[model samples]
Target: YVAPNDSFSRGVKYRIDTDKMEIEQLWQYGKERGKEFYSPYICNVTYYNEGHYLTHSGGIAYDSEGNASTELGPFAKLEDPNTVLKSITVETVNDEVALELEVNSNFYRANKFTLYAKEEGMSDLELGQGQLLGTLGETNQMDTEIPAEETGEIVSDWHEAHLTEEVDMLTFQAKFEPGTLAMLVLEGEEETRQYFISTSKGLRGAMCTGTFLPEDDRDTRTVVTKDGLDGEYKVKLIVNDKKFETGLSIRA
Candidate 1:
């Protein structure tokens, strides 16, 4: 019922509790003010004992036609602001190669993130020493639908509805390049045995899960793990396959 309105001759209604030292209000305008006026938006403020206050706020503003205009506050930041996958551990668990990782989106969108592995003793990473282990896909879009009547400017009826949507799992395959590491890298286009692992569910904030593999697996080289489908962000890569060989480590 309460709204922010600078159009009304009497000005918009506002509430301010003396003890609270803060005022919060919402305004609605009966008529749009020519493109000069900005659309409604949310704002925050912190009072400094003095009459003045330091305020920080942000939101999308629109013109008279309700078209998005300039954005306000910190929301204008350009960076996509990605999440961090922490506590990543890849080990042979039972018959399967288990990948356990933790990620914090910090309330941003993150798509399918994957893990990769490669043979050891390969000095050149670009020479193809890695393969996909698994994928963890995530989404933030809700499945809620908008009603026709409520969509129009004039309201008819109002009712709350639950969102019904599905999130897909991250997927990846395992294909160890078998040669002396040098041969596999030079060949480039060899059809290795690739294994497919299905993602079990969606992830938000963080995810911790493991996949199974055959016990006969012998991928012992300090394998290289990649993030996402493109295999970017090398997780772990060693210089040599044998313990006696010198160790060259690169982590992403």
Candidate 2:
């Protein structure tokens, strides 16, 4: 979960200076203080008052011999028998530890919320309510030209593909072979778009959410946003050198 240039983990607090137009560091954790205060992934800090704060170090991982592991813990735990997961939460007041908690598990982040309003005791409406609308980004292009041999064949029956539309994206789910070159092509009236599908992932730095992770490693849940798309289009697929029609069409 760590980048090469930004190894290790830490929490920092900054104070903005309105007049000087500069920021000053109020306090920090997990710097030269060593590995005891470090977590490679899944940790956070919560601020309450001027001098009180809560911090969570939720991704401490260790190997069989109890040595710190460079590999991410969640996947390592599933693969290795001796992988250990640890989570720690601490509260500080006036830069001094006031409360501490430790757990034998992993969490992405620790959050503290108030349940009732100050006066009317109205419930917090936003609790347990959330939605995510992802933005569209650039798509990768195929290296070679589109194959000419269509075979007039539809997608293979074993592929088991299902397309679902959302607010601004369409998700295509299908099973594919690992390390295979697969592409999803959308042929529109005025334009055509080709997007690559990842058949396999080598290493995972983190698994913050499993919404799109398939139970089978070879299964892929590819999402294509409708940001730049319009009109109607026929859906097609390319597996290796074979091009196949999907008998699918969409209006964006």
Candidate 3:
């Protein structure tokens, strides 16, 4: 059996020969000097050439108490309002650091391509919008029926709410106190859709990507697609016991 030191994120470089089907290890950047290079989830080393490579040490995380944590940064952040997420992207040549950037969010991997490489797709992208392929995952819904307990008051200044509408979806943005129970209710003449908005931080069994992780853990953003619905709906939010209209309406 083989095991790492379990302290820092791990990085390794290998030499693979296609003709002979041979593989060789060039270096491993697990425990190096006084610095740390560890990314357990989605990161990679891009070989520019011999002795030059770009390493992405994404997924570095710490708990609310400022202790190093083994849990994935993005997932842990989702589960706890105070958990921190960070990514270290370094470009090293001959074991010498030419560039290093630290971001306050987790990433799948750093980009290996040069900026505007081949003017790739930029020309085409300007011409039209790309359509999302396949179906989106099911939107979480609250089945328990609760008629609007409309409170004439607006959500408190702390939430800092904003509702942005696109052609096919509405992105609801706000901040919530950790452990606070909340729900988003959309009432339209065609039909009504209700969703439970979770502000309570809790861990999940698995995580695919952390691209959508917000910089601030308290930031709550939910994308409610307008598909399969028609007409305009009054957007409202239920915090604790009372539901209040947002003074905004969106048409699907």
Candidate 4:
């Protein structure tokens, strides 16, 4: 059966094969006023005998020609899960140095990892020699609330509202040391890409969001830092025990 609607230029096509006990459906949206538009679509398949169902939903941006131009799927597939290091930045928060790492991954579960720092030419795997900066995935969750004083004044006492917006962050604790090359190593799993920390200023105290994982439909930000180190340094991200390397530099 096919049902067409002109309200928003949308239509649905559905078919049923009773002999095979199978059902199929397709939903589509067409362009409006010779302009592009965004449409959300869903598809579902069910096997009545086996009582199994599979569903998929996403938003698509259609061009003027009624063709899908972009797919914004909200689901993650873990068959070959991987991580991408989006960016590394260093900033000072309240006189404390902070190193922020923006990462994207396809894994729902948090991976155990540790941060290490050593002299530029030193080996990152030398456990005894390399400084253990901090550890993550040891705790299930962490929460941090920014006090009202740090945020601003209360705007309404009766309504219990504040003038400045208070920020609450989910975070994990990590020690950051300045003046050394920083490296993050996953405990058991090999990384798909290597990340190197290079900056003009040294690192200080670091915090990360604990509950957020790569599969949470968003990017995860991890920050680390130490105090009192500044200057330019070339950092290399080595993957597979130096099999590949990417370089970047940070200025303060």
Q: lDDT at 100 for candidate 2?
A: 82
Per-residue lDDT for 21-81 in model 2, tens only? Answer: 9999988755643455557778999889887888888887777876676666666676675
Candidate 1 lDDT, 124-190, residue by residue in tens: 3465566656544322221332111112122111211111211222222222333322101100122
The C-alpha local distance difference test score for the whole of candidate 2 amounts to 0.75
TM-score versus the correct structure, for each prediction: 0.19, 0.55, 0.55, 0.18
Q: Write the per-residue lDDT of candidate 4 for residues 4-75, one digit (tens) a residue.
A: 122222233457899999989632222331212222332222221222222111122333344433322222
lDDT scores of the candidates, listed in order: 0.24, 0.75, 0.73, 0.26
Better by lDDT, candidate 4 or 2: 2
**RMSD values, in order shown:** 25.6, 8.4, 6.8, 23.6
In order of lDDT, best first, we have 2, 3, 4, 1
Native-vs-model 1 lDDT? 0.24
lDDT for predicted candidate 4 compared with the true structure:
0.26
Each candidate's clash count:
11, 0, 4, 6
Model 3 score (lDDT): 0.73
How should the candidates be ordered by TM-score, best one leading? Answer: 3, 2, 1, 4
